[model samples]
Target: MRRVRTTHLVLALRGLGRRRVRDAALSVLAPVVACCAALAGLTAWAGAGRAGSPTRVRVTEGRVLLPSVGVPETAAFFRIANEGGSADTLVRITARDVPGDVTLSQHRMERGDMAYRSEIDSVSVAAGERLAMSPVGVDLTVPVPSKAWRSGDLVPFTLEFRRSGPVRVLAVVVRPGTVSPQ
Candidate 1:
């Protein structure tokens, strides 16, 4: 009787195994495929982010000229490096110490003479591009504060962008007629 029972159990297991090999393979493969798909989706989501965002835009070689005598404002220059994957635009800049909004200006040549003109619009920065702001290029005109400002001082300014929002950077005050300060 015990041998008969053992034989019956072996037959039952053999019949189950032979029923459908495809079904068994699919049961194991379905979970693996689902897990692989989920991992792929997570990887793509992690890699997807707006390029040239505020977090990725770095201000380098930045400086602001000391307010010169009889000069109502001074220009702030910097090398804005966009290290991200998307383009961005600088919309506004401000300093509480200054009276009003900082103006974005660019130098344009007309008949071999370069003149200053207010941008009146945002300046675009391409992804992975370096925007060099200098005395002869695009720059920010910061108004003189009520207090006397001199060289070697630091001025705080908040730069706002269309996509990256606001970023605060300290600009060192350099002497007048200086273009790049370190």
Candidate 2:
């Protein structure tokens, strides 16, 4: 009877030891598994929308000039750069702050020093080139809102492209004849 009791005690001790070892191993592996899961999530997020193509179009230096005294319209300018291997066309410009549709217009000087403004459909930017819009050249004609505009207001504008999709930018509002705050 004493021998039987000793054998049972030894077996119970061995089972407890095995359970402790397994618990230690699981505790050490928990953090490693969590880290691996976090790394995989980050990798998947970074690879989204960049599988086979690169972002090659960049828009910068955006500014909007406030309308002068009695003028009912204003102009916005931007510097668009295309760093890709092919050319891209700027298809549309939209502003949430303004109520009316923003239109692309060109300003040209005629024979008598008079300025002519005409609405254009689209503008193209060549590869490895930049298109700078100024008051004397290509610009976006924005209708003046009913509310009074301050000098240092910020306006959001979205520029859509043929191949590069949509690029969003914030344009600074400046009084007419004031230098841009780019």
**Which candidate tops lDDT?**
2
Give the lDDT of residue 161 in candidate 2. Answer: 96
Model 2 has an lDDT value of 0.87
lDDT of 2 by residue, 11-55 (tens): 999999999999999998999999999989868856763333443
The reply for model 2, stretches above 4 Å from the true place, is 1-55, 179-182
For candidate 1, write residues 97-153 as lDDT tens digits: 888779898877678575656666778888778899877778998888878887888
Instruction: Show pairs that collide, candidate 1.
Output: 51-85, 51-86
Instruction: Output the worst ten-in-a-row residue range by lDDT, candidate 1.
Output: 46-55
